[model samples]
Target: MVERRILIIDDEADIREVAQLSLEISNDWEVLTASSGKEGLKMAVAHRPDAILLDVMMPDMDGPTTWENLQQDPTTKDIPVIFLTAKVQAAEQRRYAQLGITAVLTKPFDPLTLADHIVQTLKWV
Candidate 1:
C-alpha cells in the first residue's frame, strides 16, 4: 500500500502529539504537525500532504480563515481537509460542511481508532 501523508494543524502541543502518534502507529502514515494556522498553511503548501487535519479554533488564524486561504492557493486548494474540533453541535457541523470540508472529527477522540475514522470518512480503504 502507498504510504499516506497527513498534516495536523492544532495549537495544542498535546493534541498534535496525540494525532501524530495515532496516525503513525495505526495507519503507518507519515504525519506532519504545525502549532499554528500560519505554520500549518506554510507546511501544507510546502509538503502538499494528501490530507490536512485542522483544528477549528486557533490563534492568529482560525481554521475557517486558514481553509479559505488554502482554497485560494492553487497549490493547496485541491488537497482534502478534515476539521478536528471540539465543537460538534448540529448547527456548527452544518456550518463546517457548508465550508466544503471533507469531514469533521470531534475532540477527545480515540487515538487507536483515529486512522479507521479517517479511512471510513474518506473511503481511503
Candidate 2:
C-alpha cells in the first residue's frame, strides 16, 4: 500500500503525540503535528499531506476558521480535512456535514482503531 501523510493539528502536546504515534504505527503513515492552527496552516502548505486531522476547539484560529483559510488557499484547498473533536454534538455534526468536510471523528478515541477510523472514513479500504 502507498504510504499516506497526515497532518495533525491540535493544541495539546500529548494529544498530538499520541495520535501521531497511533497513525504512524497502525498505518505507517507519515505524521506531522502542529500545536495551533496557524502553524498547522504553514505546515499544510509546505508539506501538502494527503489529509489533515484538525481539532475543533483551539485557542486561536479555531478549526473552522483554519478550514476556511485552507479552502481559500489554492495550494491547500484540495487537501481533505477531518475534524477530530471531543464534542460529539448532533448540532455540530450537522454543521460539519454542511461545511463539506471529509469526516468528523471524536476524541478519546481508541488508539488501536484510530487508523481504521481514518481508513473507513476516507474509504481507503
List candidate 1 segments past 4 Å from native: none
Model 2 whole-model lDDT (C-alpha atoms): 0.93
Task: Give the residue spans of candidate 2 off by over 4 A.
Answer: none
What residue pairs are clashing in model 1?
none
**Residue-level lDDT tens digits of model 2 in 28-57:** 999999999999999999999999999999
| Alpha-carbon RMSD, each predicted model | 0.7, 0.8
- Pairs that clash in candidate 2: none
Task: Give each model a TM-score.
Answer: 0.97, 0.97
